[model samples]
Target: MNVFYEEAGTFKVGAILADNNTSLQIEAVHGKRSKIKASAVLFRFDTPPLAEFMGHVQKIAEELDPNFLWECCAQEIEFASDALATDYFGHTPNPVEAAATLLLLQNAPMYFYKKGHGRYKAAPPDALKAALAGQERKRLLAEQQARYVEQLNQFILPEEFKPSLSQLLYKPDKNSTEWKALEIVCTEKKLSAVKLMEKCGAIPSSHDYHFNQFIWEFFPEGTGFGELESQPAVENIVDLPHADAAAFSIDDASTTEIDDAFSVTPLSFGSFRIGIHIAAPALGIPPESALDQLAATRLSTVYLPGNKITMLPDGVITRFTLAEQAICPVVSLYLEVSDDYTVTGIESRIELIKITANLRHNELEQHFNDDALSKGHLQHALSKELTFLWNFACKLEKLRGKSNDTNNDKIDYSFEINDEHVSIIERRRGSPIDKVVSELMIYVNTEWGRQLTDAGITGIFRSQMNGKVKMSTSPAPHQGLGVSQYAWSSSPMRRYVDLINQRQLIALLRNEPPPYSRDSNNLLIAMRDFETAYGIYGEFQRSMERYWCLRWLLQEKIQTINAQVIKENLVKLDHIPLVTRVASLPEIAPGAYVKLRLSEIDLLERTFHAEFLQKQDS
Candidate 1:
């Protein structure tokens, strides 16, 4: 075979013609052609078009190829007489495309390194505190100038500079009410507060509270949230989640204003029809299109802690929350598959109708966990159809929705914070029920991603790095649900792309203008970037979660839990290993191990859970 390739259309050293007929000689010809033939050839290839070449090669006597040698050596360098080129100066940002890349880097197999380069190790941790303390000092000064900055390295670098009892108390609060009030502002600007506050070594103050206030910034303002406005009075009304006419508990009732409902019925062969109802954000949102700016800016709703900051205001997520009773816009997807899980059809186009999604996660969790609630309240108008789908494929269903159940590995913490006013049962688990629910969600998300990919539409997608990211890389498989492509569109209340995807689908369904560019390549690139940004969001969410979950975990005092390796790297015990910790051994797999280092609590990066992993045999 005539092998061919292209490299700037030129050749340099080591290009000697092989065979006794070919003395070690080389020549260059530009725009000139010459006829050359090797001894008898078993393969003949047409001169490859310029665009399709992989570099040129001719079969002369194949015997002339260099002898294969695999040699091991220590500390060796090959100096070249030629000028070192730019391509050699820096490595190509090798795009990683799979989980194996991270696995190889973490394990550091012998093949990944040469004989002389030995592993690097450092003493047990003294991780990231000195730096955090400096940061803490800076943030405190900026949050409140009046409060004397405590410079609490203890909190900043908990292990190295453990806080004294006095330092734990928040006393003599920031003199400026502005600091306190702005702290209440649940927006990124509050970081300005973190930058200004966090002074260490301070005594207790009445204002002391876990930094929960920051979460409010992530959401739209909710003044009358969790409250229902009355149009008139109804009979035998009970209390609602939002409406509290306590005195009028005389006859308070919850109204079901959800617009559309889903009906799924399993048919012969492995096929199911899906009905997706969506509430109109424009209805609750003012000026009809007023949400456009926010929809674009947020691109998607951001969820943190128990709080959710939606792209649109309460007027949308709730009032417009998908429901069957109220008229709503919806998108329906019907899919056919064999038991082996092959997508067979694209059924209905994106159909929009008024729908209700208010049966939200909590409500659903309750339906399964609470016996007294009865399954009736959870049933849809299309109960039979929905049940058929659930029965046929609850675990196999691809339209379930996106969420992580208790199974998502995390450092477990629960605070029996039985204060005079507050009592709560904190839970951090990767339990059975959680896994079942989460897996169902995974099925739906992955299917949605597939739909978008097939349509060549631009949209946001989410994927977890199967392991650590290394210098040379590829987009690792999304390990969360064990799927190739996982994305979300169930909620457009905040995510801009949800709206984009919804609009695109709506267009496709309505036979209107195509909302997304059909340029598959560009869309894929955008999707990749969106996924990367989502990773950053995950990190930020994890950092904040550590702060809150930590408070609860600390109060619970139930130390020790098993954890799994989300990513790992062999590092000097001195460095930090970034991962969430859980109290149960089940939280982590037993035999699986990865390089790790114990880290001082750095609330910012949340590097508290990375304890060294001992080899199982050890």
Candidate 2:
């Protein structure tokens, strides 16, 4: 006898050889013998053959209409498969018909709900309707996904994806249908999503693509200032004494946050007093004010090639920047120097100084460089003042024990971007302008740091210990600057740490309690936050510079270029600030030159591929 039975929710046919009441010995359709419980059998019959039974039942099941079966059945009540088959066919049903009926009833979950072995109950009217609608929705979505995949694979951007292009390209939602289809297309084309989108004209500019990605990650709240106003203009403006000198600031032309300036006054008998005036934004932006909170969050002005996000609002920066001809509020540190260029007296004051000039590096370098200074004459406005400062800065450098620092000759590259085109200008480090600015700023920072320490006030200091630089609430030595202590009090317009230190210094000058104490939570948090944000901003700046370097390479359309080996397999391209690794590079020492043949450049990925050609003689 052939028996159709259910095992593990699947139906199978086997030939029964013996029956021992509750148990039976049977051979399956595949000729494997096994012991089975008689209760497991759903139906028994003498068949044409056991092997063909299931195949015939399955075929018959397919032809059976499940809806018709459900309609013929009673609702919300259990019925045996054989009984249902008999009711449907209008006759006593055979084993094949019964098994096929059971198969259809088991699979059509929306039409019927199973009760027990070979028995089922019909679903209610509403539940079945909802299930069928959901199934249809899924079918339609599958069709839409297929169409999207097809269009994207053919290098076409679907019209429906236009509104979501930026979100999809930068911050993708994995469960989104558009992203799902894009994922499939990218896999089929063996390309990245960015590359595939660019090929499909979905991305307008690779530069914008990268920029939007950064903005999305770092400035998710958007970079716009909106209508947010700075803290109400400083009230009860203090009556500050006017300094007896005219001051000038030297910075890059693009710099709007002029932090430090200098003034020179000839005193009696070959002695002069040089004043380093720092823009005092801290006086206007009080502690815990809106502007202060905003500066705390940003920590520093974010700089990139051709663009920046200012730490303070533009209006506030304009009010405080040391622009020419404005009597800007300043924190002045004056040093009386003898004819031998040794400091004789040091004094600090809160004052207003009329800014005489805002000297930019490009034009200033032509008149105040090493060659021109050695020639002992310059045909410029601040020649006398610059000449005196140059001599004074030399004495300061010698006093710091770095009179012959090699960093003087190192190259510093600046990028000038105009309407999407870029020009890279190279300037030597430690130039006359750099020395004058750096030495004076270092002097002020060191002096102010010492003042805070002597006054027994805790402030943020930059310390270098064991060749690593870090921020601390307590004063410590900065070995790199050759200073016992270094507090960045000179750039309140640019850096948050400087602003915080500036507040502390201002309170000290006023003989008031310091705003931040030795263990203030706000002070500690600012230190940690500033360090992290500053590092992130620095890395982002470098990445953008690299992006522009690659753009410059493509813009110039040069096929071959020379690169200097910074280390093994790592080379910096000549005439630009780009550094990349060459896999095929031969073993070469640092500073060795290599010629490379350009192979490929991927701006979206910010990467390039090159082949090492030959080593060049030094």
Candidate 3:
């Protein structure tokens, strides 16, 4: 006898091999034997052949209309498949018709719900309508996905991707259709999403692509400071005492936020009173003010090759920056130095001072340099003052036990970008300009930190111990600077930590309670946030600098460059500040110069392939 039964939601025809009433052992048409429950059997009959049963049943099932069968079944409750087939066929149903009916009902889950073995109930009208609509929508979405994949594969960005280009590039939603299609194409082409998007003309400039990726994460609202409330007029602030000195600032040619400046006034007994004047933004911007909050959010100015995002607004910076020919309010640290450049007295005051000049490094270095100072003659108007300051700086360096530091021999590279072209200029560290500025800044910061400690005030400090640098509220020794304690009180216009420390110093000078107490959570939070943001900004700056270095290489277009091995396959290029690995480099010692053949420079990936040609004589 042939039996049609359902197993694991599939229908099959088999001949009964053994019967135990409750369970039957049967041999399928393919000669595979299985034990199935009798309840799973839809019907039993003597057929033309067991192997031919399913073929005939499937043909009949295909000929029947599922909708008609659903309508023919009872809607209110479950009914047996044989009963429905008998009602539809208008006669006593045979085994083939009953099995075909059962198969049709089982397949059309949207039209009928399976209740028991060979029994089903018709779905409600509303549910069937919703399911059909959802199925149609999925069908349409599949077609749309196919179209998107086709267009992307052909290097054509679909119109749907225009509005979401940044989102797709920076923070992709995996469930999104556009990203789904993009992921498919990227996998097939063996390229990153950014590279694939670039191929589809979605990314125009590789520089902007990398830059925007950072902006998306850090400055999600964009780099613009939108419609800040006007700051209080500088004249409306407290009237400070006018300083009797003509101060001048020394900075890069492109610096607009001039934070620190210097003045040298001859005192009695052949001594000079040197002033380190820092821009007093803390006087105008109070703690928890809008401008202060903005600065706190940014933490520090983000610097790149050709641009920067200032922590303060332009109006605030302009008012606070010690521009030449302007009388600006400042926090001055005066040092009474003897004829021998020994600091005999130290004093801190808040006063107004006229900025005599803003000396730029590009022009000032030509007149006030080590060579010119060594000869006892400088070509600038402040020649005498710069020479005296340089002598004092050397004294300070010697006192710190860093007089003959070898680190002075290191080279620092500065990037100059003009009309998208880059020029990398190398400047030696520990030059006259760098030494004088660095030494004075360090002295003032150390002095201010000491004062804050003596006055029982809490300030943010930068501490380096055991080769690790960190920010803390309490003062600690900076081993590298050879200072007892180091606080950042200069460059308030560029750094938020400097601004916070400046506020504390101002309070201490005025004999008022400090804004941040010993256990101030705001101070601790600011310290933590500033450290994280500063590190992120520094990394971004370095990445951009590296990008420009690569651009400079491509702009100059010279192959076969020289690089010095740092360790193993790692090498640092000669002209630019780029370090890469040469896979083909032979075993060599560090500091050995070698010629490299460069190829396959990829800006998107910020990488290149280098082949070691020959080792050069050291």
Best by TM-score: 3
Q: Evaluate all candidate structures by whole-model CA lDDT and list the values in order.
A: 0.37, 0.89, 0.89
Q: Please write out the lDDT profile of model 3 over residues 1-618, one tens digit for every residue.
A: 878888899887789999999999999777899899999887788975887777888899999998787767667798887888899889987887888888888888999998887778899989989988998988988888999999999989999999988999888899988888988998999988888889989989989998999989999988777776355423434768899999999999999999999999999999999999999998888888777778889989999999898888888888889999999999999999999999999999999999999999999999988888778779999988898899999999999988989889989989899999899999999999999999999999999999998888999999999999998988899989998899999989899899999989988988888999978888999999999999999999999988888888888996899999999999999978999989999999999999999888888888878899999998
TM-score of each: 0.42, 0.91, 0.94
Candidate 3 clash pair list: none
lDDT of 1 by residue, 1-618 (tens): 231111222211222233334222322223323223222211223344332322322221122211111021112342211111112223321211111122222232222221211221211122324444666776775654323222222223123223322222223244443334334441333343333234432213211233323333333243222332221111111221221110000000122223223444455875654433333343233221434544443444454444444545554555554543344334444556445545566454332343332343333444333232235444433344434434434345343332333444543332222342212333334332344334434555566667656766544565566563321111224754567676655555544445555555545545656544645443444455445545655665565555554444344442433333443332212111224543222343433543443335434433455554443331
Model 1 compared with the native: what TM-score? 0.42
Top-down lDDT ranking: 3, 2, 1
Candidate 2 residue pairs in backbone clash: none
Error of 3 at 418 (Å): 1.0
For model 3, what is the C-alpha lDDT against the true structure? 0.89
Lowest summed lDDT over 10 consecutive residues: which window, candidate 3?
Answer: 228-237
Total colliding residue pairs, candidate 2: 0
Between prediction 1 and prediction 2, which has the larger lDDT?
A: 2
Q: Between candidates 2 and 3, which one is better according to TM-score?
A: 3
